[model samples]
Target: MSAGLRVAGVDGCPRLADGSGGWIAVIIEPGNAMKAERIDRLAELVDRPEAPQIIAVDMPIGLPKRVGPNGRAPERLVRPRLGMRQSSVFSMPSRAAVYAALDPRLPDEAERYRHACSVARATSEPPRAVSRQAFHIFGKIAEIDGLLRERAALAGRIHECHPEVSFWAMNGETALDLAKKVKNAPHKPGLALRRRLLAAQGFAEALTSPLQARALKVGEDDLIDACAAAWTARRIAHGQAIGFPTPAERDGEGLPIQIQA
Candidate 1:
């Protein structure tokens, strides 16, 4: 829709057997927000002629070099900011690990795990390991990677954000006492906490409505994550976002490999 400057938050997940996995973008205009999914939906929002000022997505934005690797610089820098929950920021799987995850002949889950870890070790300094969780989500990572690389115009307008970091910052940048949310954790209280923080920012209605949260097919945590990202996007578009590295490190392709919240 042709409109004034808006901001957005996007999160992605795997494509389920039902073709259900994709991206979810929470768009925030002056006083309105609508949730959407898929790369096409993301394009519809970010590719408009007027386009949003900034669209923050909860995905790793860049890849490490073929050689001389340190995984990603921002992960190292952003860890301290996350404090007690620093482990929430996993070292992004190197580009090689990403491609390896897509291999069809990887056989069983163990084989896939081995391949991913091996690639990560060879590509990173001190060898960052890709969690099984991270390996499973590589499809989403690969999808965003393709979109950003193909549609170069989205560069300056789209930024990388980590939801936990966003949530921490939203709550005055302090550590949370609760445990990290698990998928089967009885209705996710973590979402409730994050929802409260977002409500304070005026996204209360969207986060509270069942119909609204179901608009995106991703998991509950992913939806809350997208909300946290929206909060960060609001800051960036309004010139209040805090960048992890004073001068962000960019990938060889020039995509910023930094975290912002």
Candidate 2:
């Protein structure tokens, strides 16, 4: 507990365009309660640290198993649903795949694709359909590419903001899911309490930070998810207990993997 802990969180709206594709936020706090005395204190804890433990990001850190007809590849893979009209979809990679791809890029390339496959799968839709959908979402024929570029830029910004923390990728699935996960995860009393406090702070920040509010285009759900990810990082850093995935649990893929903190 001598050195403080640093954690990062990222949220992505794969379906959305407008650099508003999603949001990423990082928080660093001291082991002591006095760390919350001021906003500047919190920023200093994250920015000035030498090499802290645990940074969590909420993006697809790898490419999907398939490629779109437009020759654009998925940043992460998701399962196909019946009657879904989209050519490429927003899906998550398997935990094994995510860990494999992201672990090597810790604290950098936090947005790069790492997995390799012998063959690339093609999308079901035609090139024109893909183009139409992209245009519909982004308001222009070429906006889809612009959105992807913006997402990458935001990911790069998060990495640059905290170069010293060991980054981990996290996608809570949902705010409620993240809340339940962190509430049940085991942790030292001090760290656990700190997480709760951080959660409250994030909730507040969501309302105040113009960027987060504008990106979410809604209430504080995104903030809650970001905070929950930070709490999960705290539990992971302390080597504390974490919850298990239910029998029905699955990643962006329908495949199963072990859950950890």
Q: After superposition, how far is residue 16 of candidate 1 from its true place, in Å?
A: 5.4
Q: For residues 142-189, could you state the per-residue lDDT of candidate 1 as single tens digits?
A: 766777888887878889999888887888978665544654462556
Best by lDDT: 1
**Per-residue lDDT tens digits of candidate 2, residues 94-213?**
223323333444444422232211111122223111222222222211122223344543222222111011111222221111121234352244233333454454434433243554
Candidate 2 Cα outliers beyond 4 Å, as residue runs: 1-3, 13-22, 32-52, 62-90, 93-120, 123-219, 241-261
User: Candidate 1: global Cα-lDDT?
Assistant: 0.73
Q: Tell me the number of clashing residue pairs for each predicted model.
A: 0, 3
Error of 1 at 191 (Å): 2.3
On TM-score, the leading prediction is: 1
The lowest-lDDT stretch of 10 consecutive residues in candidate 1 is: 33-42
The Cα error of candidate 1 at residue 93, in Å, is: 3.0
TM-score of 1: 0.84
